[model samples]
Target: MTERGEGSNAALSKYEGYENWKSNIPVMYDWFTNHNLVWPSFSCRFYLQGTDGFVPHTLMITNCDVVKPRVKNAEDISQFNEEEQSPFVQRYKTLIHPGEVNRIRELPQKSTIVATHNNSSNVLLWDLEAQPNRHPVNGAPASRPDLILTGHGNDVEFALAMCPTEPFVLSGGRDNSLVLWSIQDHITSLGSTKGSPKLGPRGVFEGHDAIVEDVQFCPSSAQEFCSVGDDYRLILWDARSGNAPVVKVEKAHDADIHCVDWNAQNENLILTGSADKTVHLLDRRKMFVGGVVLPIHKFEGHKDHIFYEPQWCPDRASVFASAGEDGILNIWDHLKVVGNNNENARAKTRSAPSGLFFRHAGHRYRIVDFHWNPVEPWTLASISHDVDKTGCGVSAVIMLGTTMKMQEQKHGRHLPVYAFDMLRQIWRMSDLLYKPEEDVEEEVEAELIQYN
Candidate 1:
């Protein structure tokens, strides 16, 4: 519960109640699970390569289960067994203590837990499952990052996409380059007696006219990768090739391309968002297989027209999300675009319908970026920035579908909020992964209203 105000007596009562809640493990755990609270399990730490480097801190989890008033003192303490408690709870009693909760009312959704000061241009990798208290298997600090691969001359952006098929890392940054590194390289670099030998770059993807904005490995093929950039181009390269892109799509957008996502269901489909205020669907198969150039579809709706990013839904093959300067979040159905195209082709002879299946108008500011929750495909988290008014700021909101009613029911609250925006930007809630089509509907019904 959010504390609205603090009268001296009321504050004391709140503290007394908090102390009671912290002392009871079973009651607290049950309350947490029943309310569907999520604890933070992973964090990302970043540091500028030079001056005063490698500061160590801890990233605290946010959106924890709400604490409730304690049961009467007579409640059976016999039900509490030492083994029932999580190691985390035992180590951090302050996490459950009311005094701590009151002091840190808003949990640290995302923060730098560790700092690095290596002068070599390198990228850092943190193992998500590493225990916070143990040394990493490499004998570098455990529960901390397994390795730090320093080798970039410029600021790194999106430099840590973990490959699903292999224990490798794919990253690109302002240096106009891409590098693939292995976990073993990190282990060896630690120089610990027990550390594994450091691994070096497995491969490097080069050849871009400008700083690369995004680089994605094909979901099904580790042999191929795609990238986009400020030069308004999309290039597909062979992972084995250290030279130029085999296929260069110039003018992929009219302005700088901010993001790119490959459709997991259809490897031939490429989706890109740009500062040009347009989202383009390029049929990769057409370019490579048919030797034809065709834009499968295009979306234009943002007023200010700066689209920051686009994400393809993992559960549904045809579904996608895009956010931009208009401050609206859009969910789209690609099936509708294909259907409309087929109908239009047949209509030099007849007249095709002129609408698409999509949903919009869910945010109040420029949604800087967003990610679909990996565990729950129906849910998404986004960060929005409102820069026009006083006290206006950035916030994070979790979007839920009607299907997740059980989880929503557990929380007893459903409206979105702006409190967690900064957190969403730090730790990625999910990665773009391909799912079997059998798990989701192939056709999207046209019930969604079109956004103007």
Candidate 2:
């Protein structure tokens, strides 16, 4: 993909922020690592494996530069001859995928068991542990799928999820149907197959009018799940009640809904991101009232189209993260926005949107995907499609921490409040918000003066 702001006034201002972020990394993060990918990937997920040996912690990614080259114009060409490159990522293992991976989701019960979707009707499952490590290069032979899921009449590119409660897999496709599968019996024999094995869905639900963009299983149930589609509809499904939708919100957003994620801590809450540039928080219990479903809170923090699913922080009940074409990953505290009546606090932070406490501006391009590290507290792994000088994409793992101290305790210190304006200003002045060249320069200068 071509980098934004190239040959424009915003180009310098954008890289200035990146430099500032790199300089402040030591203070802003407890730990940080950036690995350059040989090819860009639209999806990234932290593996279930621990960090005891050869690999720090296994990470799953895809390579698709052969399919869609990232070097598109002179601007990208200029970056091809840098003297040095970012740290290289060690390949724990590689799966020669059948096609470019449009999206990826792992079985929560078995992280080694991964399901990948492409521009086809089938969902390919891989037992990463059993798959032989192969070097992926141009025209490499495609690896056979350990298990293949069939039922979708069209391509199931992006909408895919795995159940947290059971060995169930959920997928949505262009066919406008939600397909469910169980890998319970196939788990033990996952890697035993030398040829392509196939599995069919236990049930198929039809409701969406357009291609399904995202699907999420209710954290607490195997039979309960939800889906959002290009039709601007959000449908909740229950296998116990047959193929029909249990609850369908016809107009979930003003634009196409791209993603939907159900909260694990609070079963009552669900998050949906749309092209409308908003994340709507829906309460399942209060979904249907007077024959209409309404969102409990509308998060208007994103400034561009929301492309990826908004993910909930596994450890925190009210915290979550959302990213999109805006090239920003915003961390929000729902409790801070929902029913918030503190006019004083609102006035002090009026420059930013309500509930937005932290913003990640590390990526120079749009953030395509991100996953919260369940094993690490407040840690995140994010990937962007921006190509570097070495013809590689950026993958970063960051542990979130605030330099702003909350309080001083007897034994140690507290640094809980991360959204303070002082810290936020560092990124905001560095091109997080678009402004005229003169204004941006003046604001950045003033910020430097204040710090000096």
**Tens-place lDDT digits, model 1, residues 339-433:** 66674465345332222333333234444555564444344555443333223121112222211122342333232111221222211111112
lDDT of model 2 at position 296: 82
Candidate 2 segments exceeding 4 Å error: 1-16, 46-89, 137-139, 288-292, 343-349, 387-452
Model 2 lDDT tens row, 1-452: 11211222332234636766555644444334344433344564521211212222223332111101111232322232122322222223445555455666667677667787767899989876687766545555667778999999988877899999999999998899999999899999988977888999999999999988899998889999999998889999999999999988988898888889998889989999988889999998887678776788788876677778899987678889898766678988887776457843783578888787577777766566776755435656676554332232222211122212134433222222111000011111112232346896898799999999
Model 2 error, position 216 (Å): 0.7
The total number of steric clashes, by the backbone 3 Å criterion, in model 2 comes to 0
Worst 10 residues of 2 by lDDT: 417-426
| Candidate 1 global CA lDDT score | 0.44
Listed per candidate, the RMSD to the true structure in angstroms reads 15.0, 11.8
